[model samples]
Target: MDHIFSPWRYAYVTSRKGDDGCVLCGIGAAAPSSDEESLVVARGDQAFVVLNLYPYNSGHLMVVPYRHASHLGDLDAAVLAEMGRLAARAEAVLVEVYRPDGVNLGMNLGKAAGAGIEDHLHLHVVPRWIADTNFMTVAGETRVLPEGLRETWRKLRGRF
Candidate 1:
């Protein structure tokens, strides 16, 4: 069998930083100058778009409000509206940059609902294509991405 290597994921899979603080909140609080390192592509008044560190696809992004809110109902109308706007912008940018066959927008609300970060509510904007999932994901329990995060951030940063 041929081996598919993704050495970058080693840091993610082995890191204990998830115990330090809320990752989303940390990214939200980071300075604008650090956006590239943080994988943040766009910022708005209420929400910002950042590429997923462990993405389902090349351009998988999350639109997160700066505030730490566990649930959607906890947010005010303006924040909610801005999150929606950011998600829309993310979709447009993903289409323009990746030419995806389709896109998936979703939110995993809590630990029971598949949220990796349960305390911070964020909307996911995932670029999808036909046959994007293959045997590697099912048989090997791994995902193969054609591009890296920095490249994805570079391609999407200016569009948003």
Candidate 2:
């Protein structure tokens, strides 16, 4: 066991904002014309797909329902169904645009479960390559994403 440092994360760890009013709610409330500013790649009637501000990989995305719900059980059937559909669409878009070796899809239900915005439930779609997790992560505890979020948004937005 050795020590690895990521001093860049100090500000994030200490200054992280609390989930007061849901971030998803703010994104959902944003006008469609401002989708790019919100990092939204796709917009559906019930749900939408946006890039994760803190991404695991270049094409990391989240499928979130417009309805601000904390838990899966809190969402209605329509929202739940649309969330699944949007997640699938997001994966498809990522595959076509990124061509990653694999994809990870999941949901963190609460703060203790690693949900940054625990008040608004969202599904994560992270793209994974064969060697995506390399020495940087193992030795340095850092992730290197080759692409920027705005660029990723541009690549996937039209595909949706």
Candidate 3:
């Protein structure tokens, strides 16, 4: 049997049990000096772009508001507008960096709606390509990524 090793995920898997804070809010509040470590590529006045810790594909990112808000209606117009603008920018950056066939932008509002973080809202920007999904994800329940997170962050950080 072939084994897929993702050592980086160990930290998340181990720490998740004890973690009660909102991940998005923590990233949003992090200092600019730690942006690279946090995988934050860009920041707008009301929102910021950070790479998804676990991505569906390469260049998967999230646009999150600075304020902690669980629902769309909880945010003001300015925050919503900036998140949209940032999501658009993320799409452009993904196209330039990965050149995927298409892009997906979405928001999952609550636990019942498939939100991993139900208390803080975020917009997911994913880059999709032909045949990106494969048997490993279906049968083995594992994801195969071509590049490492730091490498992905390096490739995308400059463009944003």
Q: Which RMSD values do the candidates have, in order? A: 5.6, 5.0, 5.6
Each prediction's TM-score versus the true structure: 0.84, 0.83, 0.84
Clash number by candidate, in order: 0, 0, 0
Which residue runs of candidate 1 sit more than 4 Å off their true CA positions?
1-20, 135-142
lDDT of 2 by residue, 1-160 (tens): 0111111121232332224455677777778898887888888999999887767778888898888788888888998899888888888888998898998888777655666777787888888788765723532534566777788888888797
Residue 105 of model 3 has an lDDT of: 83
Error of 1 at 38 (Å): 0.6
Cα lDDT over the full model 2? 0.74
C-alpha lDDT of candidate 3 relative to the true structure: 0.75
Off by over 4 Å in 2: 1-20, 135-142
User: Per-residue alpha-carbon lDDT of model 1 for 47-115, expressed as tens digits?
Assistant: 899887877778989899988899888999999999988888888888988898999888877666677
Deviation in Å, model 3, residue 127 alpha carbon:
0.5
Instruction: Give Cα distance to truth, residue 92, candidate 1, Å.
Output: 0.8
Question: Can you list the residue pairs that collide in candidate 3?
Answer: none
